[model samples]
Target: MSMFLITCSSSFAQKNELKELEKLVKRNNTTETAALLSTVEKMLPQATDDQKAAYYFFKTKNLINLANSGVDFNENRSKAIESINHLIKFENETKSKKYTTEVTALKNTLLAELVDEAIDSNRNKDYKKSSRLFEQAYNLNATDTVYLYYAASDAVNAKDFDYAESKFKDLIKLKYNGESQTYVATSQTTGKVESFGFDRKARDLAVKSGTHTKAETIFSKSAKPDIYNNLTHILLNKQNYSEAENYALTAYNLDKDNVNSLLNVLFLYYNTNRLDRFEEHAKKGIERFPQNEILLYNLAIINMQNNQNEQAKEYLSKILLLNKNHFDALKSLGNIELQKDADITNKINALPNTTTSNKKRNDLMQEKRLVYTTTLDYYKKAQAINPKDESLNELITQIQDFLKNN
Candidate 1:
């Protein structure tokens, strides 16, 4: 009987405090409400569901007010969101609508505030703060993955790469394409075309009202490729080659028509010594961009490295056809012709000191002369392309001496 009386007395006192708190909350008395909320928290364990509901509602309102007043704004905003979520969960489980409608509007207000601040932060180039705000916005509206993307992009600008990577991974997991459709129409009043971004209903209504004409829907490019490319770039910076290759390939496959995407994959494969893949893509790139100097030069170099002299010459010849002043191609052709001298010299040295051997040696010597002449011609062309290269002069003098002495 004594314990029951003590419990009843405590409950009665808690009920009186709740009434005072509700009054302070209703009056918009922030300071007193905050002070009273602290007291109410301790009494919460003994409070009934209705009392708890009222406390959550009041707490959310107070925190939002404090946030607006710039009193630990981020913390207060987060706390307010937490409180509202709790109220929503309770309302959901009990099949009650009390506070739900009001809290939803409050959430939208909070969202708008966060978005405006985030834009301001971005405009001020406070990238880290902007990233945080965008992340908060995303937490409020998880359906808007663009906010998450903005968060990741700002984190990148701030060089907060770890956070950027995590957010980018979240986008990939969500399969966020980030493609938006725009409804466009020529405004009848202004005689100009206008774009209604991702608001087809508004565009349709305007068209129906005869304020616009020639309605068309267009889609922006998907951001998935860029996301994969960014992930690959970060991984490459960390020298995690295997994982970088995975993401690079993903980007390449997703946007096969994009030459930049193909180049990114080609670059990774080339750097990783995946020559076969590089060659394959280089050929494809050449087919796509027949006049692409980089692809043509890369193919030439690849063929040269593999000792496919004829194929290398073919590619180098094409490069010269596109750009006759191609110094590297001209020098490369000279070097290829020069390499024949060593083999011919070896065969001449292997001959016996006899009549037949001398005749054969003379024939080989003539062949060597033809090779040197051809090499000199190419070297001269290269020198003409780069007249400032004194090394080319030295090479030309050496070849002249050899031809005169022989």
Candidate 2:
């Protein structure tokens, strides 16, 4: 009975292995190749302790071939790491007696490949793509402090400050006591002083500067929209409003529909109280993004201030149509109605017909009161949602006091 049970177990395991291999081969050119590889990996648990090492070797070779055949490096790298880890585990199980040299060689080869790919990608300015590869290489060999430094530099170049700071702090913790080199001091016999300074002073300076000056310079010289956008942000932060406006203008000139630059110019003109420029930019921005609440609000405010009451009403009405809860638009609309009411009252009082005059005046005033009440309610709701909004709270208080008096 024991012999029969052993035979049945071995047959089942062999069938499973054969099924996995068949699946792998059938999935040769599909995205399921990785899934197939995982299925084969599960079969390793049933492998004899000695056969595990050879199995991992075969798996590594197969993955390498797949990678060479144009599978993605990023995906293949993960598979290769899995195979190497399995081989290492099996070698350790055998007390490093079997496949120790092979496992070490494979690890070294994969590490070198990862480092080379990372360096190549970094040099090509593909920072996001290189970051994962560099991390893998660093993990394989933590002794190489240079990899961490390079990774940190790349992160900084990519504008990922948090990642860069983490990597640099890790290097500092490594306590790398600077690189050593032979130096020949100046002497009467020696022609000149020769020293190798590997303090990474240049790299440190580049990182320490932390200014996107180079990016700005490139923007100024090449007129690239992305660089111009970045420069605009930097100049805006520095309060160089004129330069920021110029950069934003350049970006807008390159791409007329660039909402970012358009909005920047709009805010710039608004802050400087350049009403004419604000109106011009606000109109353009509104045309580009008609449904934008900010654009509509800005345009409405400008129109109201300029006494373009009808146009202001149009914009406010559009905003209210889009968002019935738009408190600003509601308030502006109420103000416009109040102004209309005053105008109607004055005209009605001047008319000769006393009966029609009184009727029109009462109707207009009632309409004005209703609008005022609606505006007050909206302002109160907005203030409740954002207690820090003093303007809304003040308006609500003023309207409530006015309603109490009248």
Candidate 3:
């Protein structure tokens, strides 16, 4: 009899608390709603199924109100999600559509609010806050995995490596390639082509209404290679060379047509002292991007290291044709000329002390001076592009003295 009385009192208290919660939620009184929500959650297990349903529904509503009121935003947003999820499950189990629809609508509103705030924060350059908001948005709607991707990117920009690592791994697990098709049409009213951005139905409707023409679908490029490349960059920063190389290779394999991806892998290999792979990727990158200055420059350096000066010169000349003020290429050409002058001087010094040899030595000395003069011209051009280079100033002075003396 005592147990029954205790149950009845608890039930009466739950009813009164729920009524107060409903009134507070309707009034948008976030502070009292938050305090009462805690009281209601504790009484939930003892409440009837219908009472439990009411508790969850009101809980979700009150928490959303708290979130909008800016009182413990992150905590309220998370708790609101939990309440909504429980409400959905309970509605499903009872085979009723009582509160699920309203809860879903409320959740969508929260998701939109979070996403808009996240975009605004990102625009403000508050990357850490943006990342967290995007993550919360993703949690509210797991089907929208793009939010997770954005969260990871913002986390990387914020230098939150641990969060970025976890989110990137989640994306990889989900196989998020980020490829999609866009719809476009030419507007009949304006006589201009318009992009609908994945809204095919809207584009079709525009065409059907005789307000547009040329409805088309355009497939976007896959983003997997870029994702893996970012992961590789993070790992490289952490000095985890083996894992970095693995991810870089994954990026390379996924990037069949992306020159930037190829370049990233080439850099990774080059920095890791894997010269063979670096040369291999550099040549492959050149094949795809023949006019790419960086690829051409990298190949030139490789050839120079291999004692192939003429081939290196050919690459450097190509770079200059593509971009006239290529400072590094010009500087390299100057160094090659200096090397030729050194070789000529060595031969002249080794010549025998005789009349014919004396004449040969004089001729070689003139040739050396001519080569040295060419080097000076190259250095001067390079200096014109980068006048603040200290090394170039010293070399130019030394070359001027050498030309004057011999």
Model 1 RMSD in Å is: 8.0
Model 1: clashing residue pairs? Answer: none
Tens-digit lDDT string for candidate 2 (1-406): 9998986786577566545644654455334445545664676666566545655665675676577678786677677777777677667777654667866787899888888888889889999667767877776666666666667667767877567646655664674333444322332244444332344444334335642112111111222454455555555656778767876787778666667767667766766678788878776777789898877887788678879989998988898889887767776676665555466557656766677567776676677567568766656655655678777667777768877876
Q: What ranking of all candidate models by TM-score puts the best one first?
A: 3, 1, 2
Note the residue pairs that clash in candidate 3: none
CA shift at 133, candidate 3, in angstroms? 2.9
| Highest-scoring model, TM-score | 3
RMSD of each: 8.0, 19.4, 4.9
CA lDDT scores, all candidates in order: 0.87, 0.65, 0.86
- TM-score each candidate: 0.67, 0.37, 0.76
Model 1: residues >4 Å from true position, as ranges? 1-19, 22-31, 184-186, 191-197, 290-406
> After superposing candidate 2, which stretches have Cα over 4 Å from the reference?
3-43, 172-406
Task: Please give the lDDT score at residue 206 for candidate 2.
Answer: 39
| Model 1 C-alpha lDDT per residue in residues 1-406, reported as the tens digit of each score | 9999988987888788878977887787889999988988888888777777777888999998888788998899888878877888898887767678988898899889889999999999999999999998888778889999999989999989889989999999999999998899999999999999889999999999999999999988999998888887777778788878888889989987776677777778877889888879887887888886666776777677778899889888999999998998888898888889999999998998888788899999999999989999999999988878887778889999999999
Query: For candidate 3, lDDT tens digit of each residue in 1-406?
Result: 9999999999999989988988998999877887987888898789988788887898788787877778888898888988887788888998767677788898888888899999999999999999999998888888888899999999999999888988888999999988889899998888888999878889999899999999889987877887898888788778777878888788878875766567668767767788888878777787889898887887788678778899899999999999989999999999988889778978987998888788888889889888989999999999999999999999999999988886
- Order of the predicted models by lDDT, top scorer first: 1, 3, 2
The 10 consecutive residues of candidate 3 with the worst lDDT sum are 255-264
Q: Scored by Cα lDDT, where does model 1 land?
A: 0.87
